[model samples]
Target: MTTTELAPETTGAPTRPGLTPAGLVTVLLGAALPIIDFFIVNVALPTIDADLHASTATLELVVAAYGIAYAVLLVVGGRLGDSFGRRRLFVTGLWLFTLTSLACGIAPTAGTLVVARAAQGAASALLLPQVLSIIQATTSGEKRSRALGLFGATGGISSVVGQLLGGGLVAADLWGTGWRPIFLVNVPIGLVVLVMARKLPESRAHNPLGVDRLGTALLAVTLLSLLIPLMEGRALGWPVWSIALLIVSPVAAVAFVHVERRLERNGGTPLLPPSVMRLPSVRRGLMVAVPFFGAFGSFMFVFAMTLQEGLHFGPLGAGGALTPLAVAYFTVSMLSSRLVARYGQKVVPLGGAITATGMVALLCTTLSAWPHVTILELAPSMVAIGVGNALAMTTLFRIVLSHVPTDLAGVGSGVMTTNQQTSLALGVATLGSLYAALSASLGSRDAFALVIGAVAVLAAIVAITGRRLPDPRA
Candidate 1:
């Protein structure tokens, strides 16, 4: 294809050389850190509560604060990268993340840790969008497909590794550090990545637009209104304020959309351009992303609880139980590009079907074995789900970005990541809440089985939706 047809943002030769092998590795390393941190705290929460004497509500805030801050600022972070420089923002974000992690490690009180965690989330917001934007801007054709596939694999594996690493760190309690090591460990790794990041090439929009302050405000308000309540409501006994915020969420969302559309029509850049959202590929890919990621997030949360609370396994054992899943996801993700090239869009629905089958099998196994179920028994189903997730998500990333122009890479990445992150939080809120509520009445085994069954339904929805996605190659 001609340059004009390939990327309207450029004319003549491309402005910069493609990303080097070292640069690809650097960006992918940066990408994995934020996702790992998100899940690493799951196994550390109890230890933190005990060490800091935090109330149950405060413990929840440790997780919610990070999530809310990260989700709220993501698009703005992406915009900043596009307007300034992706490399500049990436370095800045990594620096901030390192400092905040130190703060979290040494936090003297519960309130201090909560604030530090929120700041860490903000740093993550600044860091993550740049990874996807960089990949989009710096690679193409088979190389692009391969890079995106690796990125997908990194994300899937990081979630599982986070908990596993967290458990190991907490169990080791290096020098009696207890849960502090989880956050502290990021410091050395972040510093190392910052040094390596110098190899990365900087890329940004050729005609960058000014930040949309109104759009930013509205989007933040919308997300905070929805996410905060869902994240904290059940834990706080569904207080009046939480209920009120939930009521306000949709109104803010509607206003945000209206303002964005108006800005685009008036010949101005909005935080999220309606033009990008209108792409058939972007639209369809995101529709499937919601349920697929939702199921993934909720399964991780609930299964962690099942292993620890129901089976009375320690943190290490609980995290280790997921090994089969992680291995399968990584192995499959490595080969997904070739699979997609051969099968086209058909791979996505097939992945969803496999995921649903795995979930059903898991449910059956849980119901039959109940309290006696072992990791060995869970391995087969976990592998199936992992393989399915690898196939679906790796291709889904390609499908979403397939039609986006280079000038809009940051916006597109921001939009996709925001959708994925929001869906994950919602999944944890909705299905996690269901499991908690039901476990009280129906018992843990039955409650878990019911929730897994729901996840199967979600996978089936993904299967149905996947059929509508256009092939990325086309």
Candidate 2:
């Protein structure tokens, strides 16, 4: 009855209807917007602070709220898509995202914007999982790998573009508008995606499970218990409530797993299928994803803060600094699928090594130049990280869901994305907290060097851990 003694499941050839040229575009476009929006606000946060005279706490909420809501809802959203139809949920989510974007753009106060960001995050939670589910349900083998590659590539491209665009839009100060354009710009893109979605294929779980209301509620509470404390504890100076919540988080997590197991044992539906957790592909892949994305999320937030506040760089300057990273990611990711096919999961460790080297270079450069670092000095390291990430992302995604059954595509995709999103939030919370605490006394440059050096160390761990990934070629 041991895990190793269990027989492997083989799915010979992909039999499902394939993704069309236009349909692939639709889902990926749907994916790109939310991801771009996720970090687009990073460069714009300073502008928002000045415009609304918002406190540091509220600004942190502006970013944390969206990430938290998105992470919490993703699994349930994926389950809903399985039962009700992915296309329907995707369209609905897109419309909601579009409307919320408009709301964010027009908000008159920081509080209103914060609420809008939360709503937008919820919409994103609905939209994003379907993209993965659809691909999982439809494509298989090399096609699945390629589609997922594009999705990961989209992640890199959109994030950099978001930062770049946010800086440009804020600088343009078009019609005297400032950071509003970052959110407002999504309206048109959402419209195009919605239009394209009409032509996309409609697919869902062939044997869809009913909604697990209890499990859903428990999952949300568990994530919130962890997320709220980590995100707020530092800014609030680690209040008693924050400490209490942090202590409760592991208990809630345990409860969640227990309840889910009981539900599955009783033959009732569960949010996280216990059988899925038994899959090494799913379980171990999660271990790799959490740390990798945690590093990425924290790096984005910390670097953005350092770039603008510490270096006194304009939004444009900060955005431009990441261009090399974006270029390298897009270029390398395009080839990662082939590499994944050739080398299997080894690409992930290789990527982690390269990215770690890049981080080390960045840390050294920052220390050497102090606050006077230029874009030219930063480019090589940025590109190295980009290349490393590109290799890992596409391959890791393929490996994570490599063994998921077609009938459980929604659930599996949901689980992967939920981990991905939650890890990002954790990254922001932990790394960001460390940076904020260190910045209180140390010079910003020194603090940044240490934190980024930590990020490099994180990458190294992920690389070492990545050797455990299920070899797709096996």
Candidate 3:
């Protein structure tokens, strides 16, 4: 089916205003918060365990709960934004995020903190999709391109910044709060964003589809069955339930597809329309997104462990080590639009090649230096990886959403974000588990090298498949 057939009717809402410079900043800030929160806890995990007496299993939940909730609800959040109003949901989400952050900060028990983190994840789901949806609906031509570039940069920078900020906050332990401040810091920032969000011009699908209850439930089950097992299986020793959930995941996924298709056939709006999935840009873009983001997630998780556990780096030291990566990613991402305009689709494969080269450098460094490696030793490889990632990711975002009709902007954004989020969870689960298991047999240095090698292979796959993406300008 063509996008025109799938476009929602424009009957209720009046014409929406274009996004202003200030509005772009407001939405981008909204986008950054959830992504930053996802990685921020990595540096603070040890402190959280010590302070709350959290068990290893419970500690995994601290991360997994947020991710699972965030990933599962993301598409639903987008649909809600399209149905209601993007600005309204954005503001409400910020309010809830602030309160949930406070809840996380003050929780006395590990269980309470886990629950609060899940709520915080839910709040994030409500907020993030609007960032892209608003930009898609309100901006066009060069303005849209630049806005998307900034959005991509925000996401990439936020992931690194999350770790950096987590380390800084945990080390400072302001007012004797220890790890609490990592979450508490969001309270004030969220409030300030809430005020700024007032300036965001509201937009929604003119004839938005009602939420698809069955499709939502099936999608949640599909994700939970898969993610819960991967995230918790390694820590919990691959229990029977974990294996069972893995089996159920594919079954639930098949059912989800059947349900969504049937809904669309019957003239109802499905949660994720098959038409969107059939779009070549969406399909090809996702092929790259899966491996690219999977590697990204695993690299962040495994490298943090390697630094702290192997090299005995403090939180500050570990976070500081990634400084080169953050710098390169921001610098390159800012320049990516112009690069895409000049180089077209060639940029992604070139990025993949560069990323593989960087990973290989990292692998060699780990093998040669072992536990003696320092931040300076890792800087060159990190810089290479960051530059390549910016090229691929920034371009991929533009390519994926470029063809989406404005009427389906929320759905398209949701589909892309959900794919990205799910891949991240899978990467951390699979590669992270591989690293842990290998560390015992191969030793930390070899295990890390082996994982980096695997990541390099994933980057190679991205380079190969990136050739298939249609250039947005075409």
Candidate 4:
């Protein structure tokens, strides 16, 4: 009769054979590890470069390489999970991620480390999409909402915690590994996950399906052409080839859309089905996710650089500043189910307002203490940002997946993850570059803080606008 009553009927199906609460936690943990790794290295980069004698350009490559690869392959990874079994791919991905982390830790040369990081990113691509699909397929109703909130919380907290943990490990220099501990630490955690995952259940489409090779290829090509130039073009002095590749992205993207539509018309399994785009909730949520995630990436990248290079903080001090944010994010995320269920879409706009206020606080802190602000000075802003992020992210995720039929769950998961990852890469490329370009003229400290504040404001705008979107059922 009403939305609340309808949700129970829709989501309350019998539990599958092995999909227990423990199993769901394991999947969420698996999802968090890779995301944590993604941002953890930011605070550790200076130490990594100094110890390995890596060139400045090579150091940038270390971060960009992993992210670019991870972003490019996420869609395909989701498809693989759909065609194969999510549990099988999840276990396989966990083992590979563990091995690659070991490789990264042991790598002697900068080149070797870069290669290992690329492998790690690839492994992550395989692992992350399955986490979402597993949750989507297994849980529903309050259970689904709670699980998704945890996933969102884990993602937000991982970015902050990764930096903090990286800093601590580098400072501790555990096992005489120096910067190596950052990567090595994942090995034991990953191994534990692998053992636990065996108890995880298998989940596939209700009906088996064929892989979409052409759609996958086109998606990869389109993303690569876009991110590669944006990440490296400036470092390479904007080479002719870089410009050419940048130009090719839109063309490739258009071609990808045409091909997918044509294939879908012919009764083919397009990587991204045209029909899904017609869903108002999925389409609008995605539009907001791109810019929102972009800002999140930029904030992490730029803030880490500021704390380290501009303020002369050590790795630990730089990372410690974000701890408050992480704690706040976790608290709010754990409580998100109650808030969202009651408030519905209103939760998103409120989050934006909160986040915008946090940015303002951060801006003030930077201006007042310019070259001497302590971690304590940044705490207020960090907490606000965390709370706001928890609210916006948890709500956005639910909206995106709300209308997905069980049959198309994998593709839905893939599309959402792709949007998030691509936007993250874009955030770092666009905002990081702008900060660098303005550093000399505006001064690094002032320019960095100003740029992040501006972007945060922009993100808040997008979030508020997202509140106007039609509900998923409509």
Q: What TM-score number comes out for model 3? A: 0.88
Q: How far is candidate 2 from the true structure (C-alpha RMSD, Å)?
A: 4.8
The 10-residue segment with the lowest total lDDT in model 4:
1-10
lDDT (0-100) at residue 416 of candidate 3?
74
Ranking by lDDT: 3, 1, 2, 4
lDDT by residue (352-380, candidate 2, tens digit) is 99989999998888778867989899889
Compared with the true structure, all predictions reach lDDT values of 0.79, 0.79, 0.80, 0.76
Q: 1-474, model 4: which lDDT tens digit per residue?
A: 000001112222434773688998798789888867866788887788778987545665677667766766766676677678888988888988999999999999998998899899888878877786677677767887888667766766776678688889888888677889888889999999998998887777555445677777777778778766776787679999989998888998999999989988998867678887668778988888777778777787778778877887888997798778878877887787688788877787788788888888898888889889889889999999889887787677778778877566556656676677667767777777777667757888778877877777776786678788655434
Model 3 spans > 4 angstroms off: 1-25, 49-61, 108-112, 133-153, 156-160, 196-204, 440-442
lDDT (Cα, tens digit) per residue for candidate 1, span 1-474: 000001123312223777888888888788788778877776676678778987545655676677667766777777678678888998999999999999999999999998999899889888877776687678777887898677777776787788689889988889999989999999999999999999788888666567788987888788778766776687679999999999998999999999999999999878778999999988999899999988987787778767766776666776677767778887888788899999989889989999999999898887788788888998899999989988898788778888898766556766676777667767776787778778888987888888999999999999998999999888
Candidate 2 local lDDT, residue 438:
84
Q: What is the lDDT of residue 18 in candidate 2?
A: 65
Q: Per-prediction count of colliding residue pairs?
A: 0, 0, 0, 0
